[model samples]
Target: MTDLLMNPTVARLTSRSLLGRKRTLLLSLLPLALLSLCTLARILGSLDDDIAGQLQGSLSADLLSTFGFAIMMPLLGLIAGTGSIGPEIDEGSIVYLLAKPLNRYTIVVTKLLVAIGVVTAFGALPVLAAGVILTGELGEIAVAFAIGAFAAGVGYAAVFLLLAVITRNAVVVGLIYALIWESLVGGLVPGAQTLSIQQWATAIIEKTLGYEAQLLFVESAVDFSTGLLALVGVTLVATAYAGRRLQTIRLHDES
Candidate 1:
């Protein structure tokens, strides 16, 4: 666990790179947008009951599911996970590190920690705050979405990190998974829904919230056990495979 959580130098480098200006801007926009929308939701919910009804209906379905889980986590996961190694590979710097006497497993785990750390920070906090504001309540739905977003972020970091290891087009692939597979197909196709991270996270939220939360539109297509199993299994498999793939990764000579 100690070895798995971090390595000082690697963590520092990943943190600096992941939180650089452009990426910082992207991350900042998300939380700001979520919070702003949440605040407006609260005001509107207070002004009139009808608009409040509309906002409440969309709160769980659109804001929590669509924005937080589908959009935020995967996008953050892709940027952090792939950006950890993608730029180094693109500029021919990865060869220097690849030739070093570091354990491949340690390197992979270190990057993963950095990725998951950033994802949790950016993904979970805003969702929790937004859920609370959107509903003007706590515990019932807010806490549930917070935990779901964090879990989904963790699982997403592992999967996208593996994609970074396997392909240069990892970002493009991740977007397709985030948008097309999870968003487009998962809604229309029953088989695809079973494998979706969003649904798994929703299952978590559904189970976490108290019974009174049924009034909210916190719909989930999968069982809690199945969702839990899928999220954990995918994270472990992706991380293990990424470590193995890292061993075989061929760094081109900069010359």
Candidate 2:
């Protein structure tokens, strides 16, 4: 029996599917846009620390938080997390793996690891590069948002991966959460911000960036400690639940 901890073949397959053809092009959108936006923002404006800090903070909170963390990371997470296993289950090909001696936990965990890695590479890394580009230095603001991006990636990947296991409409659900709740409601309602993944991630940014974060428009709704707990809790609960769901998964014979 192959180790349930990780199967090299599964990892390779996930990597190929995630990075394949149209998906690679899809993943490039955020990085390319971020780079272009930051490059233009930097060039069009003068370079003073005060000005740099203001611009960086504005981009970090207004632009990056709205687009990168709220929209991009979750969408990337939805695509990767759901893409990793959803297609197999839809094709009814997952039954072959389930029929084998592998632990369901192993399958869930391995696929989750791949999805998280994909988000980090495509989502978190680009945000970091964009941060550096906007600020023109590897300063605290750049580093703080990089950390926030990774945290947001972790939260998004776990939740979407669970959605993939539980529902066929994972993408639909993910879009509602990413777009409607985050973009529309969170902006209109104050309390909704407290429960948001984007807000939780900004809590980390608030704590880490210290004084520089004040230049930004919004403060994180939750405290730093609460954000950490919420992030960890969401990740653990989603991953555990997905593994449990995988154990009892019923395959339909659509042939």
Candidate 3:
């Protein structure tokens, strides 16, 4: 189990490389923007009686859901996911790493763990903070979105990490999936929502919020069961495939 699950060496190296100066700045940017927007909204709501009521009602929910869940979480997942192993593969450093006496699955799982941790810290925490700042309390609205962000973060990390393993153009493909497919098409097309990590998160948020979700108008194209199943299935399948792909990777020097 230990051999298949994680390696401290891989985890340490992946963390140091993934969270390097430039990538750290990039990861911090979205969270900073989220907190800034929440702070600004809090200030604006304070200045207006009607807006304050709305913030307590739905505006806060919209901000947390739309920007935090729909935008920031996926973006963070992409950066953390690809950064975990993409550079190593690209620069042929993966050859050295692979030459070690380690299971390929162990490497994938360790990197995936690091990616999930990064997303939890930079993605889920910010969403939670933004929700509290916007709503002025750690209520259902705040907690629900935070949980949803974490769930979505996990799914995105796995999926994007698989992309990195399979393609050098992981960033381009991930951006199109995040920006165009998930954000754009998922918004307009009803069927696409069922296939989206965003909507799966919405289902999670709705489930977590429960009756309060209705009050806040939280709705998802898919039900909680479908969403939960899809999230788990994708994460497992992607991680497994990535491990298999890594096992078969043809190193430049080997060729």
Candidates sorted by lDDT, descending order? 3, 2, 1
Q: What's the best-to-worst order under TM-score?
A: 3, 1, 2
**Residue 127 displacement (Å), model 1:** 0.3
lDDT of each: 0.80, 0.81, 0.91
lDDT score, candidate 2, position 23: 89
List the candidate 2 regions with Cα displacement exceeding 4 Å: 1-4, 46-53, 56-60, 253-255
Candidate 2 at residue 153, lDDT? 85
Model 2 lDDT, residue 81, Cα: 85
- Best of the two (1, 3) by lDDT: 3
Q: Where is model 1 more than 4 Å wrong at Cα? A: 53-61, 253-255
For this target, which candidate reaches the highest lDDT against the unseen true structure? 3
Over 57-131, each residue of candidate 3 has an lDDT whose tens digit, in order, gives 788888887898778988999999999999999899998899999999889999999999999999998888888
Candidate 1 local lDDT, 1-255, one digit each (tens): 775556777778888988999998887787788788778767977898887886655554467777777777778778778877677766767677778777778788888889888887888888888887887776456788899998888888899889988887888998999888877787558888888888888889888865644666666789899999989999989989998988887666333
Candidate 3 wrongly placed segments (more than 4 Å):
253-255
Candidate 2 lDDT tens digits, 1-255: 556678887788888888898988988787688778777777765645565566756754566776777678778888888888988887788888888787788888889889889888988888888778777778876778889988988888889889978888888998898788866776457889888888888899899978767776558889999989999999989989999999987767343
TM-score of each: 0.91, 0.91, 0.97
Clashing pairs in 2: none
RMSD of each: 2.4, 2.6, 1.6
Per candidate, the number of residue pairs that clash is 0, 0, 0
Residue 148 error for model 2, in Å? 0.4
